[model samples]
Target: MILAADLADDRGWKGPNSATPEVVELSELLNRAKIYPLHDRPENFRSPSSVSRKIGNLIGSHPSAPRNALRTSAGEVPIVNRFVDDRTPMKRQAADIRVRIRRGLL
Candidate 1:
């Protein structure tokens, strides 16, 4: 949406030299916003555990597993990259993501 908005601006859609009113209205805005990963709401969140394997063991799925919580020098636990579940919440399930962007685990 940001990119589109920028593109619209660059294309003289919102300037003094604008041709007709090429205004992307709220309905069009809704349609455009649907294309991106929306952080504000749940799309297809996953179980906080079982983040690694499609078939998760208890250890792998447990949120407080020692392995899962192990911290790096940066003081952040590693993310489950290979089997990343889009279902995972941007908040609790991925503490590192929250910490990196929003400064703490909620």
Candidate 2:
């Protein structure tokens, strides 16, 4: 989620239907890491479209979000707010997650 937020922050928000290459890459990373909310459903992992929607959610929750920003779930607001307040920690955490994924530890 943090990574998606960072991508949205850096490259501007792309609507859910048109995922950027970065979003697609993030989706791949997420699938490779096997970090699904439902652990039992390995087949139902993150797809590019899902990652794009998550990015949209993060953008929608941001203070500077555009008028047409997608509606985010209540649970996402706090996390989005934390990313808005201090992206450094989130970026560091994202880097850590990438490293762990690469090391096959995630």
Candidate 3:
């Protein structure tokens, strides 16, 4: 559960560019917003499932998601080799993707 504010302040992390319009809008909204971790908040800070459900409501699946989806061709592979300066192998990328999916992060 990475916080957006932390990513915004980390100097060593070269995160996604904020020059895009969507990032600019999000930055404007997050200005001066302080997010305390659950342990530091009030007694009724809420459980993780409640937070997850709220987030799912905000940006989760759409009613017509399946209908509007883009289908890839049989040979199409979506993985890109940009994690390191040197190219990472497709097999490693596939394995990493499987791990992430297993951990419910995908």
Candidate 4:
């Protein structure tokens, strides 16, 4: 969610297209973090499509989201709000997560 929010803030909303570079990057990051195991069902994997959907959800839940944003789940609102209200910490955590993933510590 933090990464997606950062992407949206940096690049603006790109919609939920798996082929988009933003979604693909996020998917790659998630996969590198081992968010989904190869032995798991294909549908359970954090593929580009899944990342796009999650991005959509996070964008939609943001208070300043676009008019055409997707309908967000209630459970996601607080997270989105926190990301918006405390971006510096959220970004720091995201960076930490990325470092851990790269170092095989996640």
Q: TM-score winner among the candidates?
A: 2
Candidate 2's TM-score reads 0.80
In model 2, the runs with Cα more than 4 Å from the true position are 12-19, 36-39, 42-44, 66-68
What is the clash count of model 1? 5
Q: What does candidate 3's lDDT look like per residue over 1-106, in tens digits? A: 1222222222222233444343343343333234444356555343333333322322212222244333322221111112223233533554564455456555
Candidate 4 lDDT by residue in tens digits, 8-76 = 655554465788886787777777776656577475477888877887887888787776778788777
Write model 2 residue lDDT over 1-106, tens digit each, in one string: 7777777767654454435687788878887774544566556467888888888888788877776778888877777787778878987887888899878788
Worst 10 residues of 1 by lDDT: 47-56
Model 4 scores a TM of: 0.79
lDDT values of the candidates? 0.28, 0.75, 0.32, 0.74
Winner on TM-score between 3 and 4 is 4
lDDT of predicted model 3: 0.32
Q: Which stretches of candidate 3 lie over 4 Å from their true place?
A: 1-19, 37-60, 67-106
All candidates: TM-score: 0.16, 0.80, 0.21, 0.79
Model 1: lDDT equals: 0.28
lDDT score, candidate 1, position 64: 40
Span of 10 residues, lowest total lDDT, candidate 3: 75-84
**Model 1 TM-score?**
0.16
Question: Model 1, range 52-96, lDDT digits (tens) per residue?
Answer: 111122223224445653232221112222113332342243334
